[model samples]
Target: MNKWKIILDYFLKFLTALILIFLTLIIIFKFTIFNKNYIKNNLKENNYYEKVYDSIKENMENYIISSGFSENILDNIYTNKDVEIAINNYIDIIFSNKKDKIDLSKIENKINSNIDEYIKDQEIKILDKDSITSLVDDLLKIYTNEIELYNMFDNYINLFSKLQTILNIALICLLIITIILIIVLIKLKIQNLGIIPFTSSLMLLYIRFLIYNNIDYKNILIITDNFSNCLVQIVTKIVDLILICGIILGVMGLIAIILDSRKKNKKKE
Candidate 1:
């Protein structure tokens, strides 16, 4: 009977450790990847909006050169602020799970006005109204595509929404179960409560180590160089956050164990 009770205590500790591991993962995700604001903050930190504006201008220059128009015609058509607004709007749509298209009316109008002025000033007769309209359309398309990045986030929005809900529910359930397990373990006179947190901390650290070593996140190439840079920065930030949280938990567990040991030593004395 004593052996059976010992086994049950160990089993309960093991379950608590598993729950803590999961809880740590959910908490990390909740504050990092799954949070829309976290992504937006990363984008801002990485100067993503400015890089996007430059990429758009560069792409537009290619179309302008092919269309036999002076690249100067692309100047002042849009600003970094415009790019920021469009990108933020798209991000909001993705997070909100909306199917709305990004509004490019301001960019279109600005491009059309620039083209009209360029043609009128140069007195260029080779490019007619329809041809110039086509050029304007092509330029605006470049801006839109640069901002949307081929709709990479669209396919995952619904799935992410569902997963976020599930994670929240799982986190709450695990918290309750962990509390109950700890209470039961205490009632059973299990003194190694620190083992649960210590095990969980080790688990988190091992997971972080695996991800850092296995994934070549530094050289990750996405749609564009600017986007890829932003992705790398975000990924690095996430990894660092994981490391910090793991260390914090490990320290907490160590302190708890030390305190438990001291108390046991005093009782023995």
Candidate 2:
């Protein structure tokens, strides 16, 4: 009876931990994927730079109606403030989704290398001291926030590649442990084997589904910092959940192994 109690207690722990892990997986789907779909559908498939361009155009149009542009004003001649705000949004939206994750160094190099020369050309085109001075003020603000902007992508890369990997190892170990525990309970004939593994198997299957279906980065563009931000968040969350669940299962496996070992030594006595 005491042995049966031990197995029942183990079954209870496995069920509770599995439930907690499952809930976190739901959070991953809701926050990372569902929200991404929501934003994409509402915004349409336009590039975020395109979106920012449209926003600035609309703002300029309203300004023109209320006021006016200078005679030499060029089309797309955004002020420093406009440029700063647009660039910031570009970074934000990109980082929000999780897809095609790469290391931060590589991503930053690709984006910065592509953009710097273009910005340099833009800098040379400014015709006056007022433009330069105003640009400096706006840029200072933009650069200060630049780290936060880059950090969104950085966090996602680590989360998806490293953190999720660790979690996956954990889940695998847990599942293995759970299996051993179950076999022990059964071999010992310690009452019911319980419903934990049945439910856990379902979760593992679903996680594999998300990982397979969510890799379409072509639909999403990482044209700016904002776009990078969105991509990292969504992708990392999904992968991380897979890892967390894997870890939980692995823990259960370890528990089973330990219990089995204890039971074996008792038999030897």
Candidate 3:
């Protein structure tokens, strides 16, 4: 009977450790992937808007030159603030699962106004109205494509939202089960509850190591260098966050073991 009880205790600890591992992954996904603000904050940190503006300017320059306009026509066509607003709106559309298109009225007006001023200043009358419209449309496309790289995921936003809800429910259920297991272990005088967290922490660290080593995130090339820079920064930060969580759990596990040891020593005395 004593042997069977020991076996049961070990089984319970093993089950608890398994749950802890899943719980750790769920927490990481909740904070990093499912969290919209994580992306927003990373983009802001990496100056993503400024990079986007530079790309837009470069792309539009080709149109200006082909249309026989001075490069000055591109001046003040748009600002970094405008790009920031447009990108944020694009993100909101994806996260909110809205079908609304990004409002380019402001940008369109600015480009048109600039072009009219340039044509008047140069007194050039040969440019076709359709050509001007085509130029404006093409420039706006650049902004849309750059900001909407992840628009493909828009279809899954609803599925992701449902998955997030399920994860929250699962996490709560796991926490309740863990608490019950802790109580049972304590009553059995099993002081190895720390093993669950310790094992989980190690698993997290191993997963982080695998991702860091396997993925060449530093050299990731996406739609453009600017976009890639922001993507790399976000990925690197997520990896660092995983490492931080692993260290925290490891420390907590050590503290738990130490406290349990002290309790056993007091009982012995």
lDDT of each: 0.84, 0.50, 0.80
Give Cα distance to truth, residue 193, candidate 1, Å. 0.6
- Among these predicted structures, which one has the highest TM-score? 1
Model 1: lDDT to the true structure: 0.84
Native-to-model Cα distance after best TM-score fit, residue 137 in candidate 2, in Å: 8.8
lDDT of 2 by residue, 79-154 (tens): 4444445454543444444443222343334333433454475564534657534533443333333423435455
**Over 4 Å off, model 3:** 126-128, 150-163, 183-189, 265-269
- Point out the worst 10-residue segment of candidate 3 by lDDT: 146-155
lDDT of 3 at 198: 76
Worst 10 residues of 1 by lDDT: 126-135
TM-scores, in order shown? 0.92, 0.35, 0.85
TM-score of 2: 0.35
Candidate 2: residue 27 Cα off by (Å)? 10
Instruction: Please give the distance, in angstroms, between residue 16's alpha carbon in candidate 3 and its true position after superposition.
Output: 1.8
In candidate 3 the C-alpha lDDT for residue 236 amounts to 83
Candidate 3: C-alpha RMSD after superposition:
2.7
